[model samples]
Target: MENTRVLWLYIILLCHYHWFFEEIDGLVNLALKKPAIQSSTFLNLTASLATDGLIGTRSTKNECSHTGVYHRNPNPWWEVDLGGVHTINRVSVLNRAYFAERLRDINITVISQDKTVTTECAFYQGSVAAAAWATVTCHPGTSGRFVRIQIYNEAYRDVLTLCEVVVEGLSPCDAFYFRKHPGQRLNSQLVEEIQSNKPMDCGKACFLTTMCFAYNYNSDTSACQLLKIGDPCDTTVSDPGWDFYSNCLN
Candidate 1:
């Protein structure tokens, strides 16, 4: 029951009202939330997205110098440039790399044009991957600008298969992810036809149809809701979706 509750929590985080959506493998979108005051971001590792579709693969950069990969990828280290957000409290990263995964020898640093700080936090709490939905929070002792999530060493691969990367508790800049719609429509006739008959798995419906950015599921009434999730990053990752998008049909 606890596990189910956590899963639901994760699904809720994936909703549009409070998240920033990014398209990866196209199987399902890589869903996540902006840094909240006290909440964590939802990430998935069971998927990956390229130009073609979704696949279960990691990043590997061959023929390189110190810019290497434990598993090797076209590049190493997936960094989300927090841009210019000054006040940030914590970072929640979901590790779903499965049993054969490990994020060893990692470094969590706070970087800035003027001020910077670094820590050997790779030994903070987790290993390379999170078997379940694990939470990584920051403490008062850990804070800075240019928040760099670097992989200095890895027990496994430098190419990490991350589902979502959320910077919680936004202090200045505006950043978020989530969907509150059924899907993107072109015509009123097409839209009306959909509102008449909804899907059984509304949460998972949108992603499968390739129309939805995010979705909303009412727990109590006929108030069906969904929305479009916006993108915050340029690079895409392929991971599976736990949330569904509903589609109504004639």
Candidate 2:
């Protein structure tokens, strides 16, 4: 009976250990099979190949995503959308077997969901070696939905090639959730007003603005008013052509 109890305990601990490792592995690669886009494609090598979960560094094998040549694409860039805002930890890039020096002077940036705010994650001044992995730890508090890798040198045009790009991060649950109120407008604490025809654009404008907590979009006049306070229904007044979007959940 003692031996049987010991064996059962060992089995339980082994299962728990396996489950813990699996959960950790799931958070290691957030860019796998995500929506990826690039400035231009070279031949048939598309942007999606970089996030296809293949780490093969041979460009001839068609496992890498390549951009057009210097003259064709002066500023080559590659980006991956993480679907939602996430706190990015690090980004890894695998260089192709041939011509790995093309990735020199590349800048990695994290862009907000509205595409208005950009934060530099890391920059590689030197060329990454052929068939090697270059891992970049993002700056503290770097969070965004889009990860962009681009060559910023204007002296010469360089093609951006990525064999495999991996992003590891944490996806927080308390993301911004906008609630819309039709025929209403928040009347107080106006920050800035912009001409925007769509409610999505108005919401995005408010999202990147640090002082904007809510926004009112006028349908008839195409005016978007960003408000500093987030009193959704309490402070809003009835407006015939305006709609209010609040980021406050409670």
Candidate 3:
């Protein structure tokens, strides 16, 4: 009877561990599936305000100098570098509340490594009204790193003004790591620390924290140090018995 009870307890512990691991995995998958434009790399804008403004994160109907971009040119264009290649799901553009008609005949293009693919990710054909946001979704999605928006040939030359640009998709770092980054210490902004028995336990801790991009686990001490910035590609030698997991963009 004692042996049977022991076996039942062991099974219960195993089931609990499995459930915990699966729950964490599900959360990570949900994060990967969500739209991630707050971290996008803004490029080829007339001013830094395009990126520094509320264009990506907090765009709204409010018309202010700190809310959007104003570019001068008949053929003004802008691009967003998603930092890494991603399976793009959709792109949304919010026009300035004051002069949204300036965004007309805009063409959206996705640029990959060797080729450029055109996408039908725009909702409006002509001009979107002021204080309105338009969404363009790519069916089945497309893989690209750079997404460009251009003001094509129109009868009137209009300056480019954008309240916000949002890009949604799956990230290359959704898998989150390329094995344990051996021998390197990811010394960035320290977030937190916790006791972990295995390297994978440390990885799960890092995955749960939004700011934890990397982690260094000491196998000897069972110490897990979470870091704000780290990349697997940037490997460097550290002390012995230290395994690192890096989820930052390459």
Candidate 4:
């Protein structure tokens, strides 16, 4: 009976482990391979390394992003542009294996596309262990186009280093306003015209524009038109080559 109980317990643990991974795999890392920049570079370690999708904690592995020495640089920071605005859920930072204490007193912030708004996602008051992942859950409805991580303190100066920065969130287009109307165009007030290759880009353009309520994308010509007056759900004219997306729903 003892052996049977042990075997059953092992099976339950295995199932739980599988379930945990499955839930994690369902989340989308919005910061993956996005355009990243840092305040300064240490040697050849660039900001892009932090978002390279590698979680290797060793600095020698060339997977970590490092900033200039602390004394020379007062506050070190790394930022990633998520292409467009997103409702951020959480931010995870993987500490370097050698000196994990350097990642302490970090501030993670979210910035708007227009650079007029900023929100603090999380702040770590203490150090994270080497090779360990420090995850911070953002407040509900925390949304932005840029995610920035910085280390700053008057008493202590530390270079910012990150093995990997994972941001999980929902894209702006995933909201209720992102209804697609294919082969249609909103004949409303025109805001501006820009070159775009895909519907998603057009939607992002509309989202960034203050007066833009909708956008029309022409797949054949790669032309994007921002509209000011109405959305795609309103009275739209049939245009086989154009696709309409509304940014006013949400």
Candidates in order, TM-scores: namely: 0.36, 0.59, 0.44, 0.58
Q: Rate the local accuracy (lDDT) of all candidates.
A: 0.36, 0.80, 0.58, 0.80
What are the runs in model 4 whose C-alpha is more than 4 Å off? Answer: 1-26, 153-158, 171-250
Q: Which residue pairs in candidate 3 have backbone atoms (N, alpha carbon, C) closer than 3 angstroms, thus clashing?
A: 121-136
Of 2 and 3, the candidate ranking higher by TM-score:
2
lDDT of 3 by residue, 1-250 (tens): 9999999997886665554444321112112212223112223333233444354422233321121233224565556666666677777666766555667777777777444665544534688777677777666666676666666646434455555666766434434342456666765678998898877677767766788877788888999998776444544468777877666453
Q: Name the weakest run of 10 consecutive residues (lDDT summed) in model 2.
A: 17-26
Lowest-sum lDDT 10-residue window in model 3? 25-34
Candidate 2 residue lDDT tens string, 1-250 = 9999999997886565443334321345768899999998888888999999977987778999988764467768999999888889999999889876677777899999999999999987877898899889999989999999998656545588899999888533223545667888877788999997677667666766788877888889999998887454448789899888766443
Give candidate 2 regions above 4 Å deviation.
1-21, 153-156, 171-250
Tens digits of per-residue lDDT for model 1 on 113-224? 4544454222244464543333445555543444445444344444544444444543331223222232232211111112312333343344444545444443333222
**What is the lDDT, from 0 to 100, of the residue 2 in candidate 4?**
100
Which of candidates 1 and 4 is the stronger one according to lDDT? 4
